[model samples]
Target: MFTQDSKRALTAAALILATLTCGCAFESSPRGELGADQDLLKTCDPAAPPASFVQIDGTGSSNSDAIAAERMTAVEAIARRTAVCSGYLRVTVFSSSSAATAVLFDGALKMDGATENARLKRVPEAVSDVMNKVRSAYAPAVQALPQSGSDITAQLRLAAEWKQQLGGNYCLDLTVFSDGFQNIGVDLGARALSRQEAERLAEQPAVPKLAGASVVVAGLGRVAEGAPPSAVVEGLVSYYTKLCQRTEASSCTAVSDYATATR
Candidate 1:
């Protein structure tokens, strides 16, 4: 058996080969999957947080479902995207069925959070981890994405547009997942998705790029998908690294109607 050091060396060599050859051999996600294209993503300032209103309807449950089901939702799904120029982020949340989805109701972009500090408050470790990963993993890609470092300034224009809409101050609902118990003031209930739908959706086209940045599924809510939680989470992480344009402007709440899928 390979020692841990040897295994790590192999992994590093593989990462280098994959980067130079731009090969799909190292890791890849399916078509139509949630984060398949995230590798093409550019790094941004995590300290400032994402002002862009990018919504992440991950390959799993929606924020609305968590609150209505009184389920425990714990996830840190921050990502970096070229679309945002600066990194774009989306947080997954869970709460009692009676908890309000209103907190999740960010008008346009449909990417809202509970209270202003949700990202930093609930799971700061996960948040910090994702930001650092995005910065470290996507650094070369972000630098190489444009012809010159000066061109990066122009790219920021696109980022500015995305940010104007998603600036902080949105409310959100995070789900709980541990076996530990907690007291609730209100009684509530709801339903989760069938494994078939989740599985089928998993096969959908991923965003198209999964090798550029650090794609961590910090907090994944439990589901009937049935692979061990680690396997499922790892799979989702692979998937998240692949895709881009999670929800095009057409479905984007930011715009009134379809923007046409030119890509």
Candidate 2:
């Protein structure tokens, strides 16, 4: 009933309509667009991410299994929190000299997209990878007791330097896992210090400049051996509080456990 030229034009229009329908379907399907959404995370802003630094004391005191387990749990929690906002998290082991300190883990959380579907599908896998790396990096620290003395100040200084290097208005959250027994300099374990003495000691030039940073000193009184009396434990807390204040920290919390170290 139709002419040959008319039939040919009708066939061409059908083919074009089919192609457009396929394209539309592909765009609307989750499976088809997941790859493209993932690719977007690769270009996320690096400099503006909130920064978190954790310094674990690798000295003999913090080498026990219980402490290691607690540290791992705390680090996992921090990783999860950081991932929610696509922030940066760094873990390091303390050394007597800041220059000699070892970096355990350094990573930035990546998000596929702002949509809930993208977050649910991608964030869990990313967080799992981060925890795996953190566990791997932390293995060697608990294998054997470190020979080096604990230098809490040096680690703080190193963190301050890192924050400076970041060079932005990004907030820095510092968590220190230690027994608060400084043996390298200005011995904190020598005697129970009064609040005034602690403040005076923190005024020394050796203290790091941590202006605008929030600091949490966890496991402050849980030493490996010769556990100090209540007075000494109180002294340790006071010393760290004064020290954080001296460095101009935004907030300071010296607590005995990671569960209570939240800002």
Assess each prediction's global lDDT (C-alpha) against the native. Answer: 0.26, 0.65
Residue-level lDDT tens digits of model 2 in 1-263: 86653453344323211221101101122444344334433333344455778888877765677677667766765565456547678888775667646777887665666784667367668768877877787767544434567778877888898888876555677888888875476777788888788777766747787766677777776766555777877878888878777787776777554432121
Lowest summed-lDDT stretch of 10 residues in model 1? 251-260
Estimate candidate 1's alpha-carbon lDDT, on a 0 to 1 scale: 0.26
User: Which one wins on TM-score?
Assistant: 2
Cα misplacement distance, residue 208 of candidate 1 (Å) = 9.7
By lDDT, who's the top model here?
2
> For model 2, where is the 10-residue window of minimal lDDT?
19-28
- Give the per-residue lDDT digits (tens) of candidate 1, residues 47-126: 33232222222222222343222221111221212121233343222222212111221222212346433322323343
